[model samples]
Target: MKVPARQALQMYCAHLREQAAGRASNGELDLVNERAGLAKAQRERIEMQNAVTRGELAPVTLIEEVLSKAGGKIAGILEGIPGAVKRRVPALSGDEIKNIGAEIARVRNIVASMSLADLRDSGAESDEDRGAGSDEVIDA
Candidate 1:
């Protein structure tokens, strides 16, 4: 049975949403795994310090190895989904791409100027921080 084009597109979008949900779940799992690994590494470091006090293997190399392996696993888990979604979106025209690039740069500059104090403050900076300068238009 042939589905209508709109229905097919709706099904495709639903599938993408499911995939995105899965990716989000995977991301959360990765974060939890990272946190567990971090706690484990901290514990190992403490233990290594104790071992050093008691005269053990030169220094603690195991913590570094654990951290590296955890980092690699987390990075691999996070990298797969964005590319799949990007493949589904249409490419922007040259002018549109340039506008996006400019807006991104402008936002980056604004973010760069923000200090930790500014971030923590209830009402930080003024209209100035809210893209007061630069004429980078962002079209949705």
Candidate 2:
């Protein structure tokens, strides 16, 4: 069984103390302390090795983590957008309001007609074009 690093270091120090007290032969005590020190080093190396083997250790990259956290935060803000716009923005002219509503409905209809698989496979240009600046209607 493998010993933990701290315990191995403690054992090594204890053996040194035994040698100092003349309770063990110098050669045997030194060998025991050396093995204990090696065990401590090996234990730490194995921990790092196991972490890499299990894919729990990853390269230090903040981009993915930052984007993941920010994406959810932005999505939450967008979810309350209708209320925010109503309260904060000046009222639009009736025709402008109607145009906005129609645009939203048109985008919704396009999204509702698309297959889940197609949407999942679609890239940014395809996604933006699907719901905006296009008159192509999906044939349901």
Candidate 3:
């Protein structure tokens, strides 16, 4: 890799000779690399400590728990849509509300059932839209 640059330098000195440019032993190079790695790790540790002191970083478990709770709240709100519809639209009959609930459940299941693993294992499944003989009703 250094050959091109070294060749270009020959134009400046005709009598110049090349010598061993590497360490006497692999152990010497390894020691230098180890010290460089130690310095990098120390810097990383200091950065993490500084972030924690500034309250910019949180534990992974705490973050996961907060996100999970928020997702649960959203799911609960989505599950209540049918009841809200029934309350607001009193003209809709019981069967119509049941059908709405069934449609909501189908959508919820479609969202909840999808995963990276499921996609990798069997690809994506096609879903039929509402009023396609889907009679299962889920009570919120």
Q: Could you tell me the lDDT of residue 37 within candidate 2?
A: 86
Ranking by lDDT: 3, 2, 1
lDDT of 3 at 69: 89
Return the lDDT, model 3, position 17: 29
Q: Tens-digit lDDT track for model 1 on 82-121? A: 4443455547455655555555555555654656587689
- What TM-score do all the candidates reach, one by one? 0.28, 0.29, 0.53
Q: Model 2 — TM-score against the truth? A: 0.29
Deviation in Å, model 3, residue 29 alpha carbon: 6.8
lDDT of 2: 0.67
Model 3 Cα lDDT, one tens digit per residue, 89-124: 999999999888878787777666666686585643
Scored by TM-score, the top model is: 3
What is the lDDT for 67 in model 1? 61
Lowest summed lDDT across 10 adjacent residues in model 1 is found at 77-86
- Better by TM-score, candidate 3 or 2: 3
Full-model lDDT, candidate 3: 0.73
Q: lDDT tens string, model 2, 1-140?
A: 99999999999999888877656678545656677789999999999999989988865566558756786675565455555555575585656555555665555555446665866767645646445565558788
